[model samples]
Target: MSTPTGFMEYQRELPADRDPLERIKDWQEFHKHFSDEQLKTQGARCMDCGTPYCHTGIELAGSVSGCPVNNLIPEWNNLIYRGLWREALDRLHKTNNFPEFTGRVCPAPCEGSCTVGLIGDAVTIKTIEQAIIDRGFDEGWVVPQPPKVRTGKRVAVVGSGPAGMATAAQLNKAGHTVTVYERADRIGGLLTYGIPTMKLEKHVVQRRVDLMEAEGIEFVTNTEIGKDITANELVENFDAVVLCGGSTRARDVQMEGRDLNGVHMAMDYLNGTIKSYLDSNLEDGNYISAKDKNVIVIGGGDTGSDCVATALRHGCKSVTQFGTHAKAPLERDSINNPWPQFPNVYTLDYAHEEAKALFGEDPRAFSVLTKKFVGDGNGNLKELHTVQIERTVDETGRKIYSEIPGTEKVWPADLVFIAVGFEGPETPIIEQLGLAQDKRSNVKARYGKYVTSVDKVFAAGDMRRGQSLVVWAINEGREAAREVDKYLMGASMLP
Candidate 1:
C-alpha cells in the first residue's frame, strides 16, 4: 500500500532487545526502540489484502485466527506509513483501550493469521504497533479526556485487571460514574503481581491507572468484594454491577510431599516476589527466595517460563522446567492443527533464551510427568520423581497422555513451583451473587452479551470465560460495558 512493492520481497524485522545476561541482572523491560523512519518501513510491509484476515479476529478451525479486538490494522498501518501518527493512535485507541499493555505482552494472533505469513514471515505488526503507541506517549499526544456530561448512573467493576480497567474506562466515557475495586494492595490484579516486572514494569501500569484517575474513574485498592465489602452492598449502591474478577484459583498437583515447606503455587511465588520488590528490595526476604537454590518449576506454559526467569534473576544455582506434553514441532503441526489458524509450533521466547544462557541448556523437559515430590526430614522439598510419557488422541480426538514405563527417575530440587495453570474464578463472589455457572466453574454469560441471570448483574473477562489472555479480558470488559450501558439507559452510545 505504501509503494505498491512486491510482497515477500522485503524481510521481516523487529526491534533489538538488550543483551540477555545484562537484562537478567535487573527487572526492567529489555526492548529497544525503533526510529520513526524504521517504524514507517515496518508499517509499509503490511500487504493490505482484500480479505485482511489479520483484523477479522475470528475463530476458525478450532483456534483464534486474528486480533480478537478486531483492530483496524491496515487503516492504522497506512496512517503510520503516511506520518499521520495522531490519527493512527486515535484509530488504535478506538478498539484497544490500552495498546501499551497489549503491545508489550499480547501473543499477537493477528500476525499468525497474516496472509503473508502463510508463505514467508508475517508483517512486523506487533513491533509497528508498539512503535505507534510509544511515539504517542513520547509526543504527549496521549492524555486524559473525561466525559463532558454525566448520566448520574453509577457502575461497579470488581477487578482492576485489564478487563476491569477497560470496562471502567468505557463506562466512564459513556458519562457513567465508575468505581474499580481491586483486592490487591495495588490497583492492577495479575498485571501488578502474577506477571514479573522484567516483562511489564509496574510503573507502566501505574501510569495508565493515573491517567484513568485523572479521567474521573475511581479505584479502590486492598478491598476484597465478598469479604471486606459485601456483593449486596455493591448491587444496592451502583446502578449496575459488572464482575471482571479474573480466574485466579490455581490448579494444584495432588501428589506426595505437596504439603512440603518449599512447594508453592506460581501465583503465590510471583506475588511474593513483586510484593518484596515493591516493599523495598529482596534483602528483606519477604519473598520466596530462589537464591542458592535448585529450583524445579513444574509445567511448561508462560507461568513456568516466568518462574525460570524469576529464579535466574534471584541468582538461583540451577533451574529446570518440566512439561507433560511432547515438544511442539518448529514448523506447523498440520495433522493435529490446521493452517490459517494458530499453528502449534515451537517458539523460543525470552525466558527460554535466558535459561539457556544461564544453564548452558534449555530448561524445558518435554513429555516428563511428575509422579511425586520427595521431601527432606524437615518437610522441605528435596527431589521430584518423574516419568517421560507419550500422548495419543482418543476416539473423540482429544489429546490424552500416559507415562512410559521404565522411565521413572528422581531429580534433585530445593524449590518446587507448580505453574500448572488456573482452574476458574474464586467461587466466593459468584456464590455471594447467586449467579449461575457453567460446568467449568466459570460464570455463565452469553458471549458478546455479558448479562448474568441475576438482574442488573453482568460478568466478563476470566470470571466469565475461564483462564484467558489479557486481550480477551479487555474485549469482554469493553463489550460488557456497552451492554451494561444499554441495560441501564434503555439505549447506549458506548462501544
Candidate 2:
C-alpha cells in the first residue's frame, strides 16, 4: 500500500462528466478529467487486500465480478499513489494489451469487487487506470518495441478485433511474423464501426493500429479472408492460422410488420453513422437519418443505450428504449446478492442522463413488448403497438414473463432500432474452414487451449465464447496466443 492510512483517510472519487445537455450536442467524449494529484489521492483509496477480488476476473454470480484481463489493480493503484506513473503504466501493460480502449469503454468490473466496496464506495480503479495510460501516451513513454530476432514463422490472424490484435501482437513479440486481416475499410473491427464515436474515438483506434504496424505486425485492411484471400491459401502459406472473427450475427426481434424502411439493426445504424462521420460530415447522404423524428430503440443493453445517444445527436424529436424484463432494483439486496460479484441494480448511463435532462423523464419502459409495427402506405415506419408484461419466477428459478390483459397501447415512432443482442460469429469462414461449432453456433474450441477441430487452426474471443466485453476479448486473445505459440514451437514464453 502507498500509505498506511490510505483507505481510512481518503474516499473514492471519479472524474465528473460534462453537462449532459451540452455534451448531447456533438459526438465528443463526455468525461472532464481530474488533476494528477486528485487521481493519486483517489488511487490511495485502494485497500490492496490480501486476496484482492478486484482483479479476480471471474464470473461469481452469472456476471463478471472483476477485471477479465486480470489487470494488476492494487499494484498499479499503489504505484500511482506513490507518484510512479510510468512504472504504473508498465505494470498495467503486463496484463492488458490496450489500457486506452479499456479505460475509455470498459465497464470496470474491478470496482465492483473492490474490497473497499464491501462497505463504502469502491476505489476509483477505472479512473486511475485511464489516467495512468493517458499520461504514458502524453509523456511519449509508450513506443513501438519490435522483436530483435525472427523465427521465420509466418502467422495469419483473421478479424482484427481485440482478440486478433492481441494474438498478433504477442506472436510477433515471440519473433513470429504475424499479419492481421480486416474486412472493413479500416482496422479495429467494432472499435471502428460498431461503436459510436462519442464513446471511443476512431483516431484512438487508428493510433494503436499504427503503433502495432510500426512494431512490424502487418495490418491488411479491406482484405477479407475467405473472400479476397482464400482460407485454404492462408493455411497453405502461413505456419499457423488463428480465427478471431467476432460474433457478428445480431439477434433480431420477429414481430408483425417486421419489415419496414426505417427499422434497422443497431449495429447497422451505428456502423453507418461512424462510416459517414469518417467518410465525410454526413455529406454523402448514405447514412440513416433520425433528424426531426421520434426514435424507438428495442432492448436495454449497452447497444440500445448507444442507439439512444446516437439518435439524440442526430436531432431526434424524442427517444425511448424498451426492455422485455422488468426494471432492475435501485439498491443491491445484500441478503440474496452478496459482494465480490457485480451488483444487479439500476444505473443511469450517459444517454439516459441526457434523455432525462432533455425530455423531463427517463426514456425507458420495462416489462413491455412490442406486438407489431404499424407503417405508412409508402413502407415507412410510423407507429408501434405494444403491451405491458408481468414477470414471475418459475419453479427452476428463471424469470418468465406473460402479457398482461387489457394493457395494450400504441405509440408513435418515426424510426426503429433493434439492439437486442448477438447470436454468434458469422458462418462463412467457419463453414469454409470446416471448423466445428457449438450448439449456440459459436466456434467449437476449448477455453484455455483454443484449438479448433482442424489442426493448426485456432479460435478465440467472441468467435469462441460468443458476444462478451472487450476486456474478455483481450484475455481470450492473450491466452489464445500462448496456446498458439506452444503449438507452433512446442513451448511459449508468453503469459
TM-scores for every candidate against the unseen true structure: 0.98, 0.98
Question: Candidate 1 on 93-116: residue-level lDDT in tens?
Answer: 989998888889888989988888
For model 2, residues 1-495, the per-residue Cα lDDT tens digits are: 877678889877778999999998888889889998998898888877899999999988688998999999999999988899899999999999899899988999888889888888889988888888889989999899999999888999999998999999999999999999998989998778787888898888888998999999999888888889888888989989999999999999898778987889999888888898889877887788889999999998999999999999889999999999778898877976689879778989999999999998899999889999988988989899999999889999998889999999998999999999999998878878898999999999999999999888999999999999989999999999999889989999999
* Model 1 residue 68 lDDT score: 84
Error of 2 at 115 (Å): 0.9
List per-candidate RMSD values in Å.
1.2, 1.1
Runs in model 2 with CA error above 4 Å?
A: none
Q: List the residue pairs that clash in candidate 1.
A: none
Window of ten residues with lowest summed lDDT in model 2: 332-341
